[model samples]
Target chain A: MTTSFPMNAGDVPYSYSKNSHLQREVLDGAKEMMKEVIIEHLDIKNMLSSSNKFYIIDLGCSIGPNTFNSMQHVVQVVKDKYHDNILEFQVFFNDHVNNDFNTLFRSLPVDRSYYASGVPGSFHGRLFPSRSIHVAHCSSAIHWLSKTPKELLDEKSSSWNKGLINYIGASNIEVMNAYVAQFEKDMEMFFNARAEEIVPGGMMVLISPQLSEHLLKFFGSSLLDLVNEGKLDESLVNSFNVPVYFPSIEDMTKVVEKNDCFSIERVELTHPKSKLVDEADAKTLMINLRAVLEGLFINHFGSKIAKEAFTRTILKSDEVSAWMKINYKKACQLFIALKRK
Target chain B: MTTSFPMNAGDVPYSYSKNSHLQREVLDGAKEMMKEVIIEHLDIKNMLSSSNKFYIIDLGCSIGPNTFNSMQHVVQVVKDKYHDNILEFQVFFNDHVNNDFNTLFRSLPVDRSYYASGVPGSFHGRLFPSRSIHVAHCSSAIHWLSKTPKELLDEKSSSWNKGLINYIGASNIEVMNAYVAQFEKDMEMFFNARAEEIVPGGMMVLISPQLSEHLLKFFGSSLLDLVNEGKLDESLVNSFNVPVYFPSIEDMTKVVEKNDCFSIERVELTHPKSKLVDEADAKTLMINLRAVLEGLFINHFGSKIAKEAFTRTILKSDEVSAWMKINYKKACQLFIALKRK
Candidate 1:
């Protein structure tokens, strides 16, 4: 694949994180869905008795913007409905050591009126006071391995061989399953931990890059079509490694099913909502491909060379240069807003 | 000082996370107060009824048996109260990208019925769906940054010095303030988003690592005492690098006041429940740190060195090695739950 080594280290699937652009679109879409689910399901009123403290944690709190979104929503519910400080709020923002914490906390608020602290540890393990937390949330970050699932790298096992096979075509089911199994296990640890950490009736919201053939078709078909047209070379397209691992919505559902602590409240699989546009706009809209492209170029040429290549490609591509409008994912989706059992 | 780099990079105060060495004294003692507060101010039943589609996202979810306790409690409550998957639960397992996701997930149930996912992000910003999650629950994951606040690197800051000096001593107040500002912003964003994203009356619960002299006092007169006793080294203690940016509980309440969306439900700083003692052998226990110690040592010593040093350190001192215990910080500790406006 063209994506660089970081792709291997950070690979989950459909890796778009390195994309500096389109973040707004992804962020906006995820936020909107979350608000809808929270409002529809949980009644923040009487529940948020002005007299109780509320807790919320965000796992994989990358750059923490989404964590902020989740907590702000909870605080707003308390203030607007209860209109009192009777309910204390504690929001825990957590992520791996490699995460950009400085960026995460650089602009945090002081005044300590509401409790905020770091729970340093893996979510798979215990990271809380028993039954002390209320709501737990995370988004766009779970597909990563806590470790490399390194054992799976045995390369000797049928699973390993299947995983390592040349990219014959679509997501190799065997490989996908292996990856999904790991994803499932990762989630289990996360939920089980929450099971011990959250209070009854607490909620968990998860917004992730959903797998939709229709949306992916746009990515895949378009890429393949470009390759056929010679606008994109096999090497170039091959170099584009999607950083995301999108288990079928069904598989994702099954992964959740593995945990009894939380039940699935919703499963959404709709094309990501982006502004409508023409082919030209769609090319630029391929902003999520930045990470994909960078990783590719870096692997092919090295950072410096990759940087130059990325610039050249963006600057020269008529495919991207063509249209004058914007187009969002035809079917990127989200789901799994749940409550503690 | 020896704690390691970026104190909040998921390092347990003592060293690492372990379930075997739980000193129930702290949990039990804290529970007494928790029970009273449960009776006096917080009403879990009422809160549960009101909260729906809320999520409890735990930052720094660790591995070990204790991890699932919180979810287990919630499940029991649900079984007793609803006996159905009426609520949604999403367990977000999180930590550094390099954390042990495999191990963390190993302990999680693989039932595929629970809503589960991994959140690869930080808490200092938005990590959940915008305003969508009801409760933001985090236990023992704050106070530590995903890493140290970055401004400390500014040459002009003067707040940062060179060499060993960098490793020891509390981080610059300016850096802390920066983190606080970021944290407050995180909170503000949370509330603001809650106003828009969360349902009215959604709640948040958190169990976090707080910074309070009282908390330190519970173990010793001061951190110095522990150091003097050789329980912790002076340099090692100071070299922790990460700042336990525990904003005062009082300040927390005030900060919430400033927030337009959230109201304070309650904030209590109590010792860890002492009842959480070891019934097996029956003796004083320390913070559960062994299980996680390896990770800590490796984090600081770079694996090979860490492995040797860890072995040497454990073998070298009885005081440091006596199956270390965990004594939680008191003062502005646990927050029962809160509702967002």
Candidate 2:
């Protein structure tokens, strides 16, 4: 279920602070890519002469800590390049309108060199002036579709995502196709909006969760089995579908090629250190998972039952505990950096 | 008596909320001027074609209901012009870095059409990119000098503002000239910075306190006299000088002409409804007056003594009470509209 309600720091403090450790590791990995690709490859002379306002936007800059960390990396790179000019750095932190901007501004790092401003609204459409932004970035975002494909909700349609909250466990091929269709459409809009906002020679780097291209199997699919056995209306799962889609590198690159507004400079898949390795046990994983997916569960089942349901299902599974004990081998993330054509 | 400290909403909430009714009335009076000189005279067709991003800024936008009210007027003017297009209005509320952004954001009106972003900095310098802004508005701010004239503090100089908080009643000719010199420097710098930021055809409207050209005398100069009598040290008054300078229409025009980047479109001097008519009693006026000048008093007399000094001085004056009962006859404000040349 795609939520109109924003995932704000105030509302989902636990999810952002604790459960988002995997996203943080991915951001840490990308800082090297930022230096190697963005700082080295970018036209520094042109940037110095053309303008002093080096505009940088963090697309899904949800809230504090991580957003500040990511912005610091971008600012550090710019400061290294233009240390003499007294460059005015304007960093725009963008998220949905309902996001917790209050907490974000109140907790801003006191030592920030760049001017901080919030750009509220969904990134699936235009949010800035034409040719205003120099660089754009998104981490652990873009996989969430703009909204669920309308076809999946129709009872008469072949792609009806019945009896599942996510397509990861769906047996039907049509259900998978529906999710793919939505991802393609959403990506096209995202690319088109960025093309309009970003200046020529600017760059956009997106980091998102991805499926292993060669692997066919996955772990942790048994928690739903426990849910089906536990108390809840079974048909609620039939109507509920997670809007998040993890695309393969091939699928993402194809969308980038189809858009034709940006030239693909690089694409790579990397495995970030999983939270389950050192920090999370089966019990801890259950709590973290509940923090992340409680929204989805609450949308279908009421909030009163959602926490209890996740607790009952994940706590009873011995396979979940066993799976989490080892460092996860199958999880992957796709990084795509594109230059404006 | 002039303050380096910001008169932020957090620091002077009582004063701004009460004593600032005169400023609000002046802002209300500028609505017609904005329509006539901005919407009617401006090249609206060019603005529509050049970009969908309509950038408006409120320079020295102190926190709260007045900033919101002023912004509402600016937004309304733009909306009336660009009603058909999907205009993305971005309003930057700016003040000194120490200004209360927390209270400002918290008190934003529920129905604002523009996306609100707080820009923290001094407006006497650059705050935005070249050709980035379309229209700018400021109210009751320009009278404030960037800093107090250093000449006033020189003990041997004829310009030394001895035994006074402001140049309004200065006995020495050189003291008045020092204030005028500082005003010219600050205004020139202000114009130069705005010329670099605003688009070629953009407009700037400034509303500020002014001295009536014909007035040879003033009311309420006696309040400071009472303060001089009640204070702990006499030389503190001798060294004190208010940074605020109320320029005549002639003085303002001279600066506007010197900085040729902006052409003067209109200059009007208007009298706002005096506070004596609606909600002010002699005691209330004393509290409000203290609110406005407490920062200055605290700097010279310490916070503990300042409040009690103002209370004791104002409460003892029958002359101050007589002055408050009548509609202020001599108070005047200047409204200037400028077009980027």
Candidate 3:
């Protein structure tokens, strides 16, 4: 079975809260777009007339500082739209049950404009009561598939992704198709749940990373190096597969259309400029990647092997860093806005 | 400032979850009364007509197995009352910002009847949208004053509780008055916040321990012993005051009447039978008391002195346990239910 865990939690040196600069950059780039979409499509008058309180849910909100910023921005946008009306905003910050909610709640902004609550669960299932949420926001999340596709793990299947951690740079069409199929199923579940939770006129804004082959290639090569040196087993590498899928614009559109619960208002692919461009050294890149993937690696290959692989990945940082610089210029992030019908 | 930390978190050997059998007994005794009050006074028809959703807030809900059980019983009672109606229950489990919400959320029942959310905040202030909640339940909490009475800390003040941690059975009327004054202010804030949150016909049920002089006397004398032995300073005991108060029935009624928000439906003093009568040994008593008071002790007198004090207390448990056995027979718990006008 494919397993999903939360990002490295708390504000320790390697925690997701400390190492999520890449996610912050994406959020910064999407802020204007989010504001624009709310202005163009949000049914503010209807929402206010229905209730004096506005409910916003942040699905996949990991231990924050970023989730706090994102939710604050969304509340601000809504507040600006209803400047004359007095409205109370209650934001629900949601994540996996195992997320470090103690850290999240403790570090909450003391002067926040909205009442905050944390809902812990997978977003691929029902979380809130039907027609309860006014707006749903998910960012830097949902690229994670619910689990690894079973077809890729079956020995008799042509889709078995042997010697590869992900389908990013794999030449095998069957492996890539397996990943795509899993993404489709996960998106359908996500949309169906959101459809039930969000009010009919409510909106959903999602921002997730598109595929980046160089990073996965570097990760796979690092593991292969350990195998070649007789420090790791080839069978272990064959059995491991990353439970992340970066869907294309077409793939997302098809899934949304199939659900028929939300009308896609806007879709864009943009290469968000990194604010830490000058500081994006090899060590910094490795820390960022490790912050997101360390738990997954430890769960699959054990901490000792995970540590060794990361050390090896950093040793070849010069080549990886150059490739990342080139890859940074491509459109590598997807933003989509949908309105519940 | 009177620092309020959470209960000893997680399910460790010394955690509150393992040591809260006394609280469990109180909850069990209050269950029948709670159901009777709901049936007699709950404006269920008005609530159901106003909205299909029912909201319940468990104020000061620490990490749980008790909380899960309490909330489930509440849901069952409501469901039994409205068997033919389709109603949705959403329970908000609230505690201090420093509470172990990570453990609470992870340990939630797999087959819960309500949508669960963790609200991290003090219940003495507003934690929900105004006029949104249907029922508010607080058990074995709220005897905690928002802070220790400032007068008790001032050496010049006549109310200064010198060499004593609490006002239980204290000969000084001024020290007792100081505690009563703090409880009055805290109850005012608590009722005002809950009055705004609870809908016009909503209900609130509160269960708190009444004054038990033997327990606090044992605790005070234990610390005094440390001072006599020169292991602790007398001045530290003079400055330290426990932030808890076990209000008499008259104290609670006066505060509720002064608030002028809710009409008191029932007020009863109960002596819950202990199911652990056979297990009420010296070590068991120490563990139970330690689980609830360890954080408080550690906060006031460093962990070293706290350990020394508890060791001394347990050494004299034979006398203390006898006192506890008698104290257990008297009415030691207060149950009050109120309905919003």
Candidate 4:
């Protein structure tokens, strides 16, 4: 294939090979939503006597636990609804063809009730025939940018906040805005396609990271005390790239409703309480933050200062510790269910 | 449910029912095209292998021996494709809710591969779920209007001629145009909604009676000559209220493609030749003509004259005889397919 596209900041030391941890977290999230959405949508008891076939698809699926967890419920629901109706099920696990499907499929559950396959293209919308699916399962993947958004690269972009200064060597707000724009665009395509493809009454449940505008303002007011103390190298933090694009529940609802294909059936947001926490969980939380700032750190003092800066920042952030303690317990998560109109 | 509107048109008999035999004959003519279009467009091989679930719907499915025969192939291809996979299928045999499906399903072959059900709804493309069908099939159903096209009614509003001049009645061009306009409008809604429901790669095959623009000057043009010869009731014929939309292949292609959801794949037209001499078959072939002319002769001079008039009309015209002979052997039919783009 011709490579006409210019390279951008993508791929990392972890890459697809090391993304199993993400999958595990996503699987846990899916398990939680099935009870909330699928049972209520299907009216399982009423349908038990009929042998209507049912299906679920995990769109933008990464490897591991999500594929396993979603398939389990998809299969379970089919069995529950049509135990006597000669029900047969197929669980579609889809993502970009370039993703590590080998690892994903290897980790998939081999239940007789579930079968998985790769769609071999971008998952911009629903990919099955009409009225053929009962549920749609997605987690942690929609936030990834479909492509880098434009308008974010210009230093003078409207998204830029003049008063908001970058700490050390860091990207301006424009860069971050571009990534988010990309996320929004991709999600538009994904949701619109899904609207056309989902059964008239089927449900789609999604879980993804989100950054509330309220929290962003609170942070801007001076949440990063570590950066003032040289405890955290804002430079290092800026260099790291966290591919996830977190949108507030309100923003997500707008995207889902754009095409009149979906009605937001439910929404849940979890925010932790305590503002401080200890180091171990802090590392887990800061991993994404660190990656974004890594570039700036290397640009500043090269790799040595960047590595040192990461440790220094954590040691100094008492407030982050407190916030993490509360947030971890609070379960900083956002969920929404959209049904075909 | 509360009735928001008044019910109308029930007491009125659908004048177009007079052409039911013609509808059957036209559809019969297109069997091969219908089969090929359904088989290729439905793409059961892909549907079965990719998912363990399947769905199919046939709209305007009359006493559907043809639908059953074609579906037999669909079921077989699907079964063969998914023999290694855990496959399940749900098929909905749909037509006008009042269509004699009791007989249709009786003929449906025993296929262990699928669970079948009856779906009763008008095929304005509104019955099934969005993005839920693996395959949807419609044959010979679209050309029949939901009710008589209004233009064909006699001055007393007693007769409705839908471009069809009954052998005993006159035809009004204006009345026929009115019916044609309604046909165009109704079909727009039908194809648009169908487009929205099919999955990105799903298939839709439509086989219906069509008047080919290509054949119009050559074949359809000659029918008017019979009008001059008094064999066809040009005035009473204009009073025929049957809704006939003989959309050319290009016309259907344009409609399906405009929605932007479907990609036109293949199209074909089949012509049914009149059969060799057989009393029962001949009677069926002439049923509609007989019904219409009988009304005129009986009204003018009772049953005896009606018989005499019908016999004289049939015996006098060698062209009518030739047409009857050719049509008895074969009927003209058209097939079209539009897959999700």
Show where candidate 1 strays beyond 4 Å.
Answer: A1-21, A43-51, A64-66, A109-114, A120-122, A147-172, A210-243, A276-331, B1-341
Model 1, range B132-169, lDDT digits (tens) per residue? Answer: 34434445554443444445544556544222212223
* Candidate 3 global CA lDDT score: 0.85
For model 2, what is the alpha-carbon lDDT of residue A338? 89
Q: Which number leads on TM-score?
A: 3
TM-score of chain A of each: 0.67, 0.88, 0.96, 0.67
Sort by TM-score, best first. Answer: 3, 2, 1, 4
Choose 2 or 3, whichever is better by TM-score.
3
lDDT by residue (tens digit), candidate 2, B170-249: 78889889989988988888888899888788889998855322111221244355455674555665666667788878
Better of 2 and 4 by DockQ: 2
For candidate 2, give the lDDT: 0.70
Given candidate 1, what's the lDDT at residue B94?
47
lDDT string, candidate 1, A121-149, tens digits: 45666665456566777765564445334
Model 1 TM = 0.43
Q: Per-residue lDDT tens digits of candidate 4, residues A124-154?
A: 6445544555678777667655543334323
**Per-model lDDT:** 0.48, 0.70, 0.85, 0.52
lDDT of 2 by residue, A192-226 (tens): 89998888888888988553211111212333553
- Which ranges of candidate 3 are over 4 A from the true structure? A48-50, A211-214, A277-282, B48-50, B211-213, B277-283, B329-331
| iRMSD, all candidates | 11.2, 4.0, 0.7, 17.6
| Recovered native contacts, candidate 3 | 0.72
